[model samples]
Each structure stands twice: as C-alpha cells, then as structure tokens.
Target: MIDVVVIGGGPAGMSAALVAGRGKKQVILIDEEKPRNAVTHETHAFLTRDGTKPEVFREKGRRDLLKYPTISIKNSKVLSIEKKAEDTFEITTESGDIINAKNIVLATGVTETLPNVKGIENYYGSSIFSCPFCDGWEMKDRPLILIAESVQALHVLKLLKNWTDNLIVTTNGNKIFDTDQKKMLEINNIRLIEERIIELKGIDGELQSIFFESGEKINRSGGFCTTVLDNRLPFIAQLGIKVNEAGFVIADVMGHTNIKGIYAAGEITGPSQLIVSASQGHMAGAGIIADSCEEAFQSIQK
Candidate 1:
C-alpha cells in the first residue's frame, strides 16, 4: 500500500506529497485538473511568485515535484473513498481504479457561486474576482464596485478600500448587515446600493458598467463580489468527517481530522493564502509520517 495518498493537485496537495516523499514514504498525488482558480489569469501575494500566471506556477511546481522518485502524480479524479481497514483507505477513482494507502490527505478546494448577472461569467476571472489580496493590485486606482450577497460582503468591501478610493457596495437587494455596519461604511464614503443587479455590461472580458433591475446604471471599471462557497466534493460527509459551520473540514493544528488515518489541508480546511495552505500541507505530511513511525515502533516493542 502507498504510504500517503493526496487528493487534488493544487499547491497544498503537491506540497504534502513532496514532504511525505522526502521522508522516504511512497506518496501518490491525485488530481482532476478542475481548479477553482483555473479561470484566474494571474495569482498574487505568494512570495517570489507574485504576479505569475497560475498555470505557469503550477507547471513549475509539477516539474520540481518530479525530482522525487518516490512521489508519483496521477491525472485522475477520486470518485469515492472507503476504509478497507483501520489503517488502510481505499480510494476509488473515476476511471474505476482502486488505490490503497495507509493515510489520505484531502486538499480539495472550495467552489464559488457566481452572481446570476448577465455577462458576468465573461469577466469573472479577469475584471471580476473574489480575493482582494490576489487581484487588488491589478485593479488599483480605478472605479470599483463591491457586490455583496452575504455578511462577508462587508469585510470584502473594507479590504477593497485599501486598493481603490472610489468604491461602492452593491448589496444586491440583500440586507444582511446591521445599522452599525451601514454607519461605518457611510462614514468611509462608501456608497451602499441595495438594488438588484440585472446585468453586467462589458467588452472583451473587461467590465464597463452594472445595470440594476430598477433601470439604474452605474459605470465602473471593475468590481469584486461575495460568493457562497461550497466544497468541490462531498467526500467529507461520505467519510464521516466533521466540518465547521463555514463548510470547511475541521482539522487540528497538524491537519488531523476527526476521522482516523485521514487528514486535510488547503481550502478544504479554510480560506487561506497560497503560502499558508502549502505550509499546512507540509505540516500535515510530516505529522502523518511521525504518527506512522510511532505506530510501527510501538508494534515492534509489543
């Protein structure tokens, strides 16, 4: 059986496999290539990789990971997982192959629900984005709009203020905030619009204006929107793992889940920076190795 099986080939999964492989453990990295940020043109805030295209960074990461002979990557999706024994996990792939590993690392990320505004998908990755730290620099010094549909909208709008001065918040007809929230935003010169957005007018994936259902139009260069996020896979529920209210896997500091022999990292655990997610993967991998070693040593003593 393989020592470790990492699902999802993003930065977190790759980082975990590398660490496990370096520890002399046989590791398998499984990925489907359906990345949450696949639509994004550039990735930012990652030290030494800032402003680099997401694809470029991933390609380079794959090449570097190939240096470890003990690590292998499979271009396949995990359809389901079953616990074959106390210490072995049987992961079934979409291609019908079954992989047995002593431990499993779930790095499956979150999926974003884009607004139903017409023509929004065309500019989703370019002119419209989610993370402010990732795309704020590219949108600096421009007329920007914050489209919020949840309580998190207020936080996102506050963060966007750091990059652009001319900013407006579109609640999209949802009143999820309280009076204090409205007062704070008004004090900051951020206009709050509760009108429902009907459409996004843009050209060549560059957003130009937001059209409201009330026949009102606001011209803006670009904007960020809040989204309700869901896990890409329901494997957490299938494995009987506990997830936080935010729908993220509940993991300890070492990435250990409530289930035995199973751990998780990356966006599956929570929303974190690229570097932070990678670091968590490294820690989880090392923790798994240590636990396995301890088990073997105890058995020998017995």
Candidate 2:
C-alpha cells in the first residue's frame, strides 16, 4: 500500500504529494484534469507564480515532483473510496483499478454554479470572474458590475470598490441587499439594480452590456459575480467526513478531518487562495507522515 493517495492533482494535491514524497513516503497523486480553475486564464497571489497560467503552474509543479522517485502521478478519475480497515482504504478508479492506500488526502476542490444569465458563460474566466483579487487588476478602473445572489454579495461589492470607482451592484432579483444597504451604496455613488438579469451581451468573450428583465440595460466592460460553491465529491458522503454548515469539509488547521485516516486540503476544506491551499496541503502531508511513522513505530514495539 502506498503511504499516501492524493485525490485531485491540482496545486493542493501536488503540494501534498511532494511533501509526503520528500518525507520518504510513497505517494500516488490522481487527477482527472478538470480543475476548478481550468477556465481561468491565469492564477494570482501565488508568490513568484503570480499571473502564471493555471496549466503552466500545474506543469511546473508536476515537473518538480518528478525528481522524487517515491512520488507517482496518475491521470485518472476516482469513482469511489471504501475504508476496508482503519489504516487501509480501497480507492476505485474509473478504469476499474483498485488502489490501496494507508492514508487518503482529499484535495478535490469546490465546483461553482454559474448564474443562469445568458451569455455569461462566454465571458466567465475572461471578462466575468468570481474573485476580485484574481481578476480585479485586469479590469481596474473599468466600468464594473457586481452580480450576486447571496449575502456574500456585500463582501464582494466592498472588495471590488478598490479596483474600480464606477461600480454597480445587482442581486439578480434576489433582494440580497436591504434598503439600508442600498442607501449605503447610493451614498457612495454606486448604483444598485435589483432587477433580474435577462442576458449578458458581449463580443469575443468581452462583456459589453447587461440586459435586465425589466427592459433596462447598462453598459459594463466586465464584472464579478458570486457563485454557489459546493463539495460534490461522492466519497465525502461515503467516508462520512464531517462538513460544516457552509457545505465544506471540516478540517483543522493541520488538515485533519473527522475521519482518522483521511485528511483534506485546498478548496474542499473551505474557500482558500492558491497559496493558502498549497500551504494546507503541505500541512496535511506532514500530518500524514507523522501518523504513518507513529503507526510503524508502534507496530515495531508490538
């Protein structure tokens, strides 16, 4: 059995495998290549890797892991996981291969539910985005809009103000903001449109204007929108990993999940930046190494 089996070969999974491999543990990293950031053009806030394309960053990371003979990467999808014993897990892949792992690291990230607005998909990852910190600089000083369907809209609105002065907030008819909040935005010279978005008209993946269901329209170069994030992994329910009220897997700062032999990192734990996710993966690697070493020492004493 391998010392660690990391599910999802994104930054978090790759980082975990590298750390565990460096600790002299045999590690297997499996991925399906459908990362949450696959649509994103470039990743930001990762020092020395800022503005690097997601694919490029991942390639560099995998290349670095090649130096460690103990680490192996598989391009595959994990179908399910069965805990056969306390220290053993049987992970079934789509190809019908079964992998036995002493420990499991779930780095499967969250999936975003794009708004139902027409033509938004064409602009997403280009003109429209979720994180201001990631795409704000690119749209700086441009006419921007904040589309939200949740309370988190307020937080995003506040963050976007730093990147653009001309801003508008819309709840897509959800009424996420109250009268007081609307007044506050108006006081700051920001427009609040509570109308439902009918469509996003753009050209060449660049947003030009948004049409409201009420026949109103506003011109916007680009904007950010709030998305519903959920952990959609079937193994989370199968393994009985505890999830918080926000529907995110619950893991301590050290990446210890409620399940003894299972740990989690990256967006699966919660909302995290790229660097933060990588750091969490590193911690999870250390935790796995410590636990495996302790188990071996105890076996020797026995």
Candidate 3:
C-alpha cells in the first residue's frame, strides 16, 4: 500500500507530497487539474516565486518533486474515496484505477460562485477579481467597483481601502448591510448602490461599465467582488471529517482533522493564499510522517 495519497495537486498537495517523499514515504499526488486559481493570470506574494502564472507555479513545483523518487504525480480525477479499514483507504478514480494507501490527505480547495451578473465570468481574473491582496496592486489608483452579495461585503469594503481610495460598493440588489455598515460606507465616500446588476459591459474580459436594472450605467475600469464559497468535496460526511460553521474542514495548526489517518490542508481547511496553502501542506506532511512512524514503531513492539 502507498504511504500517503494526496488529493488535489495544487500547491498544497504538491508541497505535502514533496515533504512526505523526502521523508522516504511512498507518496502519490492525485489531481484533476482543475485549480481554483486557474482563473487568475498571475500569483503574487509567494516569496522567490512572486508573479508566476498559476499553471507555471504548479509546473515548477512538480519539477522540483522529480528529485524525489518516491513521489509520483497522477493526472486523474478521483471519483470516490472509501475507508476500507481503520488505517487504510481505497481511492477509486474515474479511469477505474484503485489506489490503496495507508493515509489520505485532502487538499481539495473551495469552489467559488461568482456574482449572477451577466458577463462576470468573462471579466473574472482579468479586469475583475475576488482577492484584494492578490489583484489590488495592479488596479491601484483606478476607478473601481466593489460588488458583494453577502454580509462579507462589509469586510471586503474595509479591506480594499488600502488598494484604492476611489471606490463604490454595490449589493447587486440585496440589502445585506445594516445601518452602521451603510453609515460607514457613506462616511468613507464609498457610494452604496443597492440596485440589481443587469449586465457588465466589457471588451475581451476588460471591464468597461456596469448596467443596473434601473437603466443607470456606471463607467469603471476594473473592480473586486466577494461571492459565495462552498467546499468542493462530496465525501466529507462519509469519511467522518468535521467541518466548521463556514463549511470548511476543521483542521488544527498542523492540519490534523478529527478523523485519524486523514489530514487536510489549503483552502479546504480555511481561507488561504498559495504560499499559506503550501506551508500548511508541509506541516501536515510532517504530522503524517510523525504519526505513521509512531504507529510502525508500536506495531513492532506488539
């Protein structure tokens, strides 16, 4: 049986597999190649790898793992994972391959539900973005819009003040803000538009203007948004893993979930950046190694 099976080959999975492999563990990193960051053009704030494209970052990460012979990367979709035994799991892939491993690590990230406005998908990751820290610098000093659909909108509005002063906050027709929040926006000179968005007019994914159902139009260069996020995995309850109130896995500092012999890292565990996910993966990998070694040692004493 393999020592570790890491699901989702983004930064977290790749980094986890690297650590496990370097520790002489037989690690297999499985990926479907659908990364959440696939929409973004460039990744920022990762030391020594800042501004690298998402795909290129993963490619370079894979190349670094080639030095470890025990690490194997597989580009296949996992259909399901079943706990065959107390310390063993059977992972079934869409291609009908079954991988049995002593430990499983879930690095599966969250899935973003963009705003319902028309043409948002085309503009996402280009002229529009979700994370202010990631894409804010490029949009500095430009006229921008902040589109939010939930209570998180208030936090997003406050966080974005660092990037640009000229800002407009819209609720897309939902009155999610309280009196205090509304007052805060007004005090900051941030126009609050509660009108429903009809469409986003742009050229080649570059945002130009926002149209409301009231026939009002606002011209803007680019903007930011905070949309709904959901955990992408379907087997959390089946595997007895605990999720927090935010629908994210409840992993500790070392990425240890409530389930034994199973671990998690990255956005699935909580909010994260590329570098943070990679760091979490490394810690989880180390935790798995330490636990597995203790188990092996105990077996010999029995």
Candidate 4:
C-alpha cells in the first residue's frame, strides 16, 4: 500500500503529495480535473502566482510534483472508498483500478451555486466573481453590482465598499436584508434592489447590464456575488468523519479528521484561499508521516 493517496488535484492535494514525497513516502495524487474555478480566467492572492491562469497554475503544480520519483499522479475520478483494514483504505476509481493507501487526504473542494440570475454563468469567473479580494482590484472604481441570495451578502458588500463606491446590491427576489440594513446601505449611497433578476445581458463574457423582472435595469462593468459552497461527496459522512454545522469537514490543525487514518484539507474543510489550502495540505502530510513513523516504531518494540 502507498503511504498516502490524495483524492483531489487542487493546490491542497498537490501540496500534500509534495510533502509526502519529500519525506520518502510513496504518494498518489488523483485528480478529476473538474475544478470549481475552471471557468475563472485568472487566480489571485496566491503569492508568486498571483494573476496566473487557473489551468496554468495547475499545470505548473503538476510539473513540480513530477520531479518527485515517489509521487505519482493519476488523472481519474474517484468512485468510492472502502476501509480494507486498520489504517488502510481501498480507493476505487472510475478507471476500474483499486488503490490501497495507509492514509487519505480528502481535498475535494466545494461546488458553487450562484444566485438564481439568468445568464450568470456566462459572466461568472469573468465579470461576476464570488470573491472581491480575488478580483476586486481589476474592477475597482467602476460601477458594479452585488447579486446575493444569502446573508453573506452583507459581508461581501462591506468588503466591496473598499474597492468601489458606485455599487448596487440586489437580493434576486429574496429579502436577505431587513429595513434597517437597507437604510444603512442607502445612508452610504449604496442602492439596494430587492426585485427578482430577469436577465443579465453581457458581451464576450463581460457583464454589461442586469434586467429585473420589474423592468428596472442598471449597467455595470464588473463586480462580485455571493455563492453557496457545498460538499460534492455525500458519502464522506459514511466514513465516520465529523462535519461542522456549516457543512465543512471537521479537522484539527494538522488536518486530522475523527478517523485516525484519514485527513481532510482544502475547501472540504471550508472555503479557503489557494495559499491556505496548500498550507493545510502540508500540515496533513506531516501528520501522516509522524503518525506512520510512530506506528512502525511501536511495531518494532512489539
């Protein structure tokens, strides 16, 4: 059995495999390649890799992992996981191959559900983004709109204020904010539109204007929105790994889950930045190495 099988190819998975390989542990990195940010044109806030294309960053990361002889990467989808023995897991892939590993790094990131706005997908990852900190700099000082369906909209609105003053907030038919919040926004010169969005008109993936069901329209160059982050793997709960109320996998600082042989990292633990995910993966890898070494040493004592 391999020392570790990382079940996601994002920054966290790659980082964990890197650490394990450096520690001379056999590691396998499996990636489905269906990243949540696949539509994003550029990735930001990752130091030394800021403004890099999402695919380009991944390509570069895979190349770095290839340098380690003990680390192997498999471009395939994981279908199921079964516990074969203590501290061992049998991972079955869509390719029909079965891999056994002493440790697991569950790094499958979250899937996003944007506000129920028409044609949002065309503008998403282009003009309409989820994180202001990631794309706000590019759209700073421009007329922008925030389409949110959750209370998290309030937090995003506050953050976007730093980038632009000409902003509009719409709940897309959901009354996520109350009268007090509406007055607060109006006091700050921010417009709040609580109508349902009919359509978002854009050109070349660039959002231009949003049309409401009430015939109200506003033109915006670019902006951010709030999205629901969900775990794609429901079967993870079957593994006896604990999850928090926010639907995030519960893991300690070292990425150790309730299950002794398994670890959780990246967006699975929670929505995380690229740098943070990578750091978590490094920690999980180190934890596995430390635990495995102790296990072997105790076996020798027996």
**Candidate 2 error regions (>4 Å):** 299-302
Candidates ranked by TM-score? 4, 3, 2, 1
Clashing pairs in 4: none
Q: Write the per-residue lDDT of candidate 4 for residues 99-140, one digit (tens) a residue.
A: 998889999999888888878999999998988878889889
lDDT preference between candidates 1 and 4, better one: 4
Tens-digit lDDT track for model 2 on 1-302? 87799998888899999999999999999998988888878898899999999999999999988899999989999999999865689999987789999889999888889876777889899899999888899999999988888889888988999999999988888877778988889898899888999989989889999999899989999999988889898889888999999889999877899988899999998887888899999999999888878988999999
Local distance difference test, candidate 4: 0.90
Q: lDDT for every model?
A: 0.87, 0.90, 0.89, 0.90
Q: What does candidate 1's lDDT look like per residue over 1-302, in tens digits?
A: 98899998888888888888898999889999887789888888989998888889888878877899989889999999888856689999987789898999998877878865667789888898888888899999799988888888878988998999999899888887799998998999999988888988889889999989899999999989887788857678887899998889998878899988898988889887788888888888888888888989999999
In model 1, what lDDT does residue 159 have?
90
RMSD of 1: 1.4
Better of 1 and 2 by TM-score: 2
Candidate 1 positional error at 104, Å: 0.4
Model 3, residue 18: C-alpha shift (Å): 0.2
Weakest ten-residue segment in model 1 by summed lDDT: 111-120
Model 3 worst lDDT run, 10 consecutive residues: 79-88
What does candidate 4 score on TM?
0.97
lDDT of 2: 0.90
